[model samples]
Target: MATLNRRRFLALSGLSAMGAWLGTASVLAAERDAAGLLPRNLWTSPRFASSPFTVGVASGDPTPDGAVLWTRLAPQPLEFGSGMPPRPLLVHWEVAADPQMRQVVQHGASLAHPELGHAVHVELAGLLPARPYWYRFSVADHHSAVGMTRTLPAADAPVDLLRFAVAGCQHYEEGHFTAWRHIAEEPLDFVFHYGDYIYEGASQPGVRSMNGRPFTNLRNHVGEQTYTLDDYRRRYAQYKTDPDLQAAHAAAPWFVTFDDHEVDNNWAGAQDQDGTPSEVFLLRRAQAFQAYYENMPLRRSALPRNGHMQLYRRARFGRLMDLHVLDTRQYRSRQVPIADRTQVESPARSIVGAGQEQWLFDGLADRAPRWHTIAHQVSLGNYAREKDGVIVSSDDQWSGYLDSRRRLLEHIQRTGQGNVVTACGDAHRHYASDLVQDNRDSGIISSEFLATSITSGADGQGEDEFARNTLRHSPHLRAVTDKRGYVLCEVTDKHWIGDMKILDQVMQPGGTLSRWRRYAVEHGRPGLQEA
Candidate 1:
């Protein structure tokens, strides 16, 4: 490794982010082994470290040729500063063609800056498409565990099959992450964690007891609601230390987006549920955003800038699928009271914002692939509950943004588009619904499959009155279940199959899992059918 100039290192840190790449685009454009791309002075320091890869390694935002590799140096994951001093560390990384890690393809050294929680994000370019790559991190002689990631198929190539898992809403204190452990064992090409990776609340005790031990006595959040950067960082560290969550990350590359719990419960665009002043909440939001970016294996494009983050982006899997990942919370109107939500269906009400909505429209207008799937945080279909024999719209979901929802469905119907499906999270229970212009008989414009929580709802009953009443009032909802698990999706040219994997219990270790239900949406078809 080469030496780094302290002055130049400090200068680069002050630059602003422009777009897909960071402000240091010039450095990223250089050759793989180019010196100064990352500060290397820390490699020779008397304070050089060992065992820095305590938080494990992760990779995400895979493209046709490459992906982003992530790892944070933390020997003491729960401690302040993660047991590192206020300085950068020289972190070496590599990409290999095989799991044995012998056929090295790409290798480089980068700085794990203390400003970013001693985390190193290495974005690699110029690798083969539609193939798996293995990666790992090293700080001096201490090596991190190997992680596997795969690049998407070439944009124009024809793809035959793609398999992945969809999951989210993992509250740490609720129960063990048995769902993620099972998901790790599946043969998946990728994973979708659609928000709520960490809940933004103080831990609850005695409310949940597993294996005869009360949760209050087991573990809890380190502080009050996360209001500072340190609070959010420590909270994330606590959740990331879970062995099962780590195992799922090590299994395959992940594509992630955030929901309410990531920052605060039911926060909408610059507004907190409890009405904290915008100026004050913006600072909290900034801290939460930074912590989220530091921990996840996200590309620089998703990095936080000036109290905001860009999360919505597009990914492709050859000609078989085009995924439009959305950010529903960042640019949406505040949640309205149930009585007023239905009346506020004006064109001004937006869930995806104008720019992102236009992007979605343009993507749909273009010649599309066999499957058009929207990966978002909330349910798109109408989910009603029976209150005194009256069905009411859910204000927190898409139903509240009535005009936008209608326009989206109308656009699909006008274009005669087919095979449009949505993979959703946030709701703790599993729900499968058909998206239509109005009622179920109005014709299905799209389909939605909601993945249940990983551990947010501990030891959930397989069936409950909530499910029974929801199904009774909402005809479009094909299936509903109260369980903790994920949804496995298999996409082929002719059919898209979804398997709802439900866990019997999350309160204990080694919870048993089973396929609760299976649904299929055929090519040129809009709604889901029993597989």
Candidate 2:
């Protein structure tokens, strides 16, 4: 085989990301060994006394040609700055056709910079699409766990089936991540963790009562609510050390975006729940955004700069489905009181900002895919909870931004768009519902499947008064469960099926996993039906 020249090599690998630190635009091609990794002499490698790949490996933002490979070089992840020296280190990575990595396909070297918390995001762009590939990262003597990732099918190609999972809300102090273990074992094409990946609060202090039963926190956070870049980095490092979460990331490529808790609970735009000043909060928001990009399997395109990250992008699975991931918290207006019907119905309100709202409106009407799906944070339905014996609406959900919700739904109806299914988090409880215009009996428009948390809210005791009240009053709601788990969706040309995978407990290891609810939507049909 002919050796790859500088232009061909640059086109195949993402070595340019490290150009600032490495002081070079191209690397001379070096002879490879049977293992597909480069020879030690050709690359500058740092020898870590202890393994720095403590957070494991992950891949995400897959295009037709390639995906982003992510890992943070952290040996002591719990301490400040991940206990790493402030310096740049060369890291080698490779991809292979076989799991054993004997059939090496492409390989290259990149630098992990301390400015980005020693994180490496290798963005490869020349590989076969619609097929599975194995990848890993290495330093001088340490190698990360092998992760499996696949590219989406070519845009014009037809796909027969697509399987993926939706999961999020993993508060470290809540409970164990047993659900992630099961997710790792599932045969999935990709995973969407919609938000609240890390709870910003400090350690939980004592026992609490739920349903008159005494329970204590199963774990604890390291510090107070994350505010600084180091604090956010430490929080992410602690969460990434979980074996179950690591396994899930290695299982398949993922699509990740943050909700409010990544910065502060119930935060929207520049305002926080505690009424912190906008300028003060933007500093924290920027820090949190940087830490989020550093830890997750995300591309540099989503990198944080000046407190902003472009996270609302689109991906696809051939012509079978269009994957539209939305960012709801970053650009939303201040949340209004649910009791204030007048404020909730205001036309100026928005949960997905104006730009993202327009993008969603335009894409939903596109005729390329048979199925159109939206994965985001927060619920998107008219749900109400009981307050003072009166059924009051929820301000944390779309019900709070009634006019905004109406505009999107009306667009879907007007454009004659169908097969619109939304997978969302932040509710903590799992909900399967058929969305309608203002809960009208004849206003069937789309289907919504809300994923429960991985460990947040601990092992909940079934439905509570709030959930019961919401379900009873919300005419479109079909099912609600407080179990800790995720949603598994399988789609084809003619049908879309979502399974509500549940767990009995998360306070202890080896929680039992089961499934009782399955929501189905037929081709050309919009609303969901119990299947």
Candidate 3:
């Protein structure tokens, strides 16, 4: 396998012709007008039809010579419940060493079935590893925008850098994905989506779309409103339609995990507190898990069976980075009561379950990479009461499971693990913290970076005060921002930098993004600091 820098890779691939081949801004505007997918016609014909390609194209699970490519086709647009004919379309994929693809490396075909809502995932193999690659998809006469992807380095290879993005909690009804658009413009090897990819439950009545229309439900509400395969699939399809999300997906490969929104808000392992029977919730979970698998570019082994999903996995980027993706939603105890939030601190209350805990510990113990990253959903750091009067434990967070969090942090501290940085989502706000093991005590420590929502919350206005107050109350917290955006990370052998990119407003289609803050973790420092 060979490695090349961005300039050489682009020069070799002929990406300079992207504007001409992919379509010019003017031409896309014409296409958008002809297609009518955007409101008020930002541009006619936009590059791809105004379809859900919004979640974009992404590749993940990169191996030495192969990677998994993903994209969901939205030919029917966003008119939910209008059962469009399930067309079995032939989708073509191509990977190139150069942007021009003059140096085509791999090419293949995948079936985009309407039954699966045209979501197509192709796992391409036999390519060079530790190298950069460009890819694109074509269905019928329509061609997807070009995307960037990379393969992991050889298991024992000495790696110099590993760049990636981390984000989650995108509520379509909350705001636009301008932040995603900005992220798409940056260079990234892959992305880690830490759950809340879509809010499976109904949108709150007062929520409004970018166009001021009341938020629409992707599915017609029914029953206790969950545990159905169709319901999950429809929700995913609806989310897949966002153009900004599509652009982000098209920009790089992604590693993902689910939090509460992927199923129901605050849903713990096999536990539904909404008066639903345990059996019914479990069945619904199975359906949701299966639907999630079908939509994601996941390997067959990770697929769900008998209503259970295995989300814990590992991905290595040469010797530069080792990402331990955790399944916090599965194999965990239920949320504790607000009053007894501190009382629920029991080791028996597992977030990743016993098996997953072992897996994570083992991965960390190996210490094979320059950087160790935990792509887990939700905050791992403590978020206790900010003031005496405020009620703090939102059982869904690590705050409720203090014992479990301590055990994991203690493991990292005891092992003397270096660069053990955690990437998380769920709080709907961007945060940077020095994950001290004994946050209440001074001797123990670790580091974590929590990303803001892609669109969830009211334009990034969810519980921001609580987060700010929590940060102020806890010295371990480095920074906090209640903004709608994502986190961009640039990892190298010597250091890892996390950039919080914030959008002005998500309620509109296109907004500006400004850097809120930046933090850095040195090669051997298990903590974060101002960059």
Task: Give me the runs in candidate 2 sitting further than 4 Å from their true place.
Answer: 1-45, 210-212, 439-442
lDDT by residue (tens digit), candidate 3, 21-96: 3433444355447653222311222233433344457777777887777777665544442233443444567788
Error of 2 at 172 (Å): 1.0
What does candidate 1's lDDT look like per residue over 196-277, in tens digits?
Answer: 9998888665655643434442357777788888888888888888888988998898999999988999999999999899
lDDT of 2 by residue, 4-80 (tens): 34343333234533332343324523212222333232325466789989999999999999898888999999999
In candidate 1, stretches whose alpha carbon ends up further than 4 angstroms from where it belongs are: 1-43, 46-50, 208-218, 341-343, 439-441
Q: 1 or 3: which has the higher lDDT?
A: 1
For residue 410, what is the lDDT in candidate 3?
81
Which candidate wins on lDDT?
Answer: 2
Q: Distance from true position, residue 167, model 3, in Å? A: 0.7
Error of 2 at 417 (Å): 3.3
Listed in order, each prediction's TM-score against the native is 0.91, 0.92, 0.81
Among all candidates shown, the one with the greatest TM-score: 2
| Shift in Å, residue 519, candidate 2 | 1.2
